[model samples]
Target: MGVFTKFGVRLLLALVLLCSCSIGYESDIDYSLMPVKQGDKWGYINAKGEYIINPQFDGANVFTDNGLARVWVGDKCGFINKKCEYVIAPQYSSATDFFEGKAWTVKPKGAPVLIDTKGRSCFTLKNVRTVYNYSGGLAVVVDDNEMFRAINTAGETVFELSGPAFVTNFVDGLAAVQNMDRLFGYVDKNGKAVINSQFYGADFFLNGKAIVRADDMYGVVNKEGKYVINPQFAEMQQDYNKFLIKIGEQYGWCDERGKIIINPQFENAFPFFGANLAAIKMGEQWGYVNKEGKITVNPQFQFALPFIGKVAWVKSADKWGLIDEDGKFVVNPQFNDVLCSYRLFIPVRNYVVSEYFDVEGIISWINMMLDGNKVDGMTVTQTTISGFRKKYNLGEKGVSVEKKYSRDMSYEIYANGTFYENVSDGWWGTTTKQLPNARLDYVTIQLKLKDNENTRPLYDAVINALGGNNGKRGSGQYVKVKASPGIVTIYVSDKQIKDILNDNLGWSNY
Candidate 1:
């Protein structure tokens, strides 16, 4: 099973799992059905924004080349076909996207295993600390002994590195490895060091060359370890046949032989995208520049992204929108954020900056409760069960309120929302002592966790909004209650209610 830390939980969570392979593996992507958010629920939509699947799943991912997408049901994850039918039931505690007809999955309290699209276990991986996505017919794994090795789809160890060496996933038939000397080099799939560990830094091969750092400068090296471009630039990156090089404080473009194609002048720039136009920053705004260094698009937007096909996503006035190659607004700036997958722009509202969780709206609602203010036209401490029912008309809205009696003559009201939705579950309670006109003393909201990543930003944002990690307040303190492995709950009350909702749930200041 994977271990969890305060901030390091699910460190292996990745947004994109497929990589380029040279071993004739299928790598085509399906862009017909893209994941979109509709009022806390996730569903699939076409490029024209028509719902192909209704908003129901707790979470949704893009359909892979194999015509299957991963969807979440409550806490367990499963795979679904393009028709929104389950090909694999929601059972795995953790799972990865299918690549080349195979995926890696971990069941509850079980070791990791490789499964095919039909959900049949190909083989089990024992004592593996970490497993990366497969590339070039092999996947990299870190063993319990902290050693790196590569395993094929059949679960056989193809090669294992000796000594204290760190390696990366294969790309372009080569993987970068760092030797005991702390220097980087290239190694083939057969565990042979093709290039000596002599550079301060090295990157995976792209096209036929790679960017390497030596003598505190960047250059390009070919497969034969020969310098195609000598080390001289401060930094370098490859884009197609062009190279984006930075010198001192300016960015420009260079050719395969280190010839200056565009003079280094822009403050910041991205690699060339569609139509050979690159986004470059000037002053405090961003625009587009052609290969000839001509300003094609005027600098005006607060932020801009590379053109994917015919349009690109840009930010203005803190809102994201889509723009055509001519810099005209193709879509108005109304969404809180936008995500791009396979050249499709997906608009999302109330989005958090983290890739894993989207709970900005949930946090904002919780903050209102903590402030003892009105939330959704209802105040936490002053709202009674009867008043709440009257205000929202739960029956009319088709929302069922579950009632439970406690041993202390107190009753609790439990309500469940859409699975993995903004507010997954909610709780309200009152004791007989305050009966007839009883008011709520506490309110709790739970948010579902689909997967995990570097949650430091989300954690820090919540802490800052709730008066820091100490959970200080004027009338009451906020507590972060740990629920199941895939759930997080926030509690706001006039006084501590940890004992009332006791399931031995751990609590900590926000």
Candidate 2:
């Protein structure tokens, strides 16, 4: 027999035996299985409140679409089938609900890995600074270098992207991305810029339509970047085939082609569910609205959730109850909480950001250093300054130079300071002390630019101030300033010899 079939038989037999010996019984939310608390422990009970499984677990989650639920034993978590058999052992520190026959989990002090139904490890990803669950056969991850990438089931990189400044995730075949200009656009699986970056914000496409923002207004746009709905509504919502639009503070319903099916009248609204019915609020109470904007279920309850299989959970005067499509109470208001557990098997989307890094802070620090003047840490001498001046053609009259500090990938800056032979005089004749000779003080500074070409202007300005590097005289005493790929060294000490450096970047004293 299949695993679920065998477990079902065992569960039925246990329920029958328990019901025969129990004193009283009550039905659960869906009348399938109920949760009971006994002596501080929780377990599953039948529709009649009879024990299906004894209260042995510390906590338990609702069963998922894969017919398995997560249960906690003391401090550890494990998955159990309908018959209460361990499918995946409780070894991971934390885990998400299973998706596409696999689940993402984290080991103690280890990287995140994917595990199959048999608890077999697929592969462990490295440098995964942050990761999300799997969805559409891929997951989004940010590496240690702060680069965003998408990985498939085998942990292979499918594509590397620049950003998702506002909202982005693959839904159909396109994923939203934010360009360098902070505008939103769509990209295909191959990382090609499919749509031009123009919208202020956007969402994943559903039914060949996506919600987009333009001029601080929300509207629906097609895959071809054409707006089916005009950019006018303050809010928009999609439910199956209907569109919910809100103008000002009042809510209304419209079709996909920007046609208003219902006038803006209700105070609030929600997406439509079973039988084309939507839950809406009239004043302070909630009710159901149909596609024609007709009120079918009267507004009576304080709050009402969407229907499932013709039944829904409702609230009245701080009490909870269950109601049918005709608004008749199936379960009277009594309990403090009510749950529609029968239809709780919703799939979790994998394209989400769990942990985000502070990109702005790092950029700010780099900008600060570009504007700083005071230099600290390692120092240079006078003789070394002369060598730099001669090497880079600082002209006949030497000038004071400044070197900024910066770090590499490892966050460490390796500086080759100037050194010279030192001679010392003592009472016992004369001796030489091993020490640097020149007083050339060069401060290393790191400037992070979005593009390397941006340094060209600064380089030209510095070289001009130093009277040109090719033995050509320009102006200023301190000459021979040069800049290369990822580096800049200037030989100027006048401090007032015309601060030629641009104010584009902020510098700090190291």
Candidate 3:
């Protein structure tokens, strides 16, 4: 989805705050140093409780390497240094950081244009609609005609390719692109068709090979676009070039040679190679494995994230915590929401910065889950998600919920505030619940809310209302729930969010 478009729909979506861990424990993060929201914006305050930058901007983008930032001033884009200097004037509509010394930006409603450290337009990027950050010697741009092309450091089209096609930039020497026949293939930097357009799908070349799909079967090919392994698996998906495929929905990873590095016993597996670790799922839990396919961290997390910086997130029951690479609890999965930290700075207009960072925490988990299912680097809601919450002491609760949805539905566990949907409502649901008392709160609920025609998105509907996404929910601009809270009070902005907690709970009215 286009970043701004998603941002638009989400602008009104509610934010949530989950109390995953106990309040205090020594953390590398000075709890006092985490950014704070001042009314409608996030501001930087040191442990001394002083605003490093005045609490003013609408949002703040995470700082980057140069001690500079991209902040939005009103609707214009600009850059600022840590000293709070507006180094790059806020004049454009949107902007990104400097890479190889040049940043890509766009005028309001305009295509992305390149600017050097001096902030001069490399050229008037006349027709392209969207762009990617400059990387690996090229930045992909989509023209007015919707063709994908690349530009080099000199602000010249080093290469160009036509579409209806993918904007996936070349990784290594190969990029994934669709052909005239609409089948996906790999292309070399010289625009040569290194891999034939024979696969129904293919990911960019990574390490040395790419996974190609024809019909529903999968296989591997080397950088030269040669079939290193013929298509055979019933299903295969690529992660940074390595393959994670299924044999009857069981997943494993394989090298370009089709050698299964991680065996096919996992219910779910990821090709995210970190340190020497990989993540795999079995039953309802997640664990870590080494390149040798040895189970390193036993499947224990309710849902796990690929390890980054030796810390991977794990969930046991209703809480998520962090485990180090050695499978020891580093930051135990106890915080209701966990946020990854970024520490560099960049130049941004004041308004953009205000709009960016203030709401980042709430979207972290939703984005993490979406990253796993993203088709290409592009994120969208195409796959259906459904699950059930086992009501305490209810013998047939699971069976009853399953019978309510499509038989193909795959589910994980259910806890308080779990969003369980049937076939009737999709992933962005109109059905959900809040089980503050863990699984003990047995509240059978249904919400059919329509706030602007279609039912307000169910995920955004309830979650937004609950204080799930940093609790930045707009007043009454969400799903009107009619629930029975059993434990913690329903809250919004920490005010015991009471849009539906009335009559029975009688906390407050909407």
lDDT of 2 by residue, 1-510 (tens): 111111101110111111111111111112344444456676766433455777777766655546676677876677777688899877665676566677777655456777786778898764565666665677777766557788888999988887643244465677777777878888877777788889877766666787777976778888999988888887775544657788877888778787789888888766553245666789999998777899989999888776545555577988655577788876665434432331231122332122222233443443343222322212233335445455445544344333322222112221224334545565646564433234454333333333344345444544443345323232222323445543344433313323335332222222
Q: What is every candidate's alpha-carbon RMSD to the true fold? A: 20.2, 16.5, 22.3
Query: How many pairs in model 2 have backbone atoms within 3 A of each other, for residues 3 or more apart or on separate chains, i.e. clashes?
Result: 34
**Winning candidate number (lDDT):** 1
Which ten contiguous residues of candidate 2 have the minimum total lDDT?
7-16
For each candidate, the alpha-carbon lDDT, in order, equals 0.62, 0.56, 0.49
Tens-place lDDT digits, model 1, residues 358-447: 245446655664555433445555666556556556652322243221111111233221211133234564332213244656555544
Q: Return the TM-score for candidate 2, rounded to 2 decimals.
A: 0.59
TM-score of each: 0.59, 0.59, 0.51
User: What TM-score quantifies how close candidate 1 is to the native fold?
Assistant: 0.59
Per-residue error (Å), model 3, residue 228: 0.9
| CA lDDT for candidate 1 | 0.62
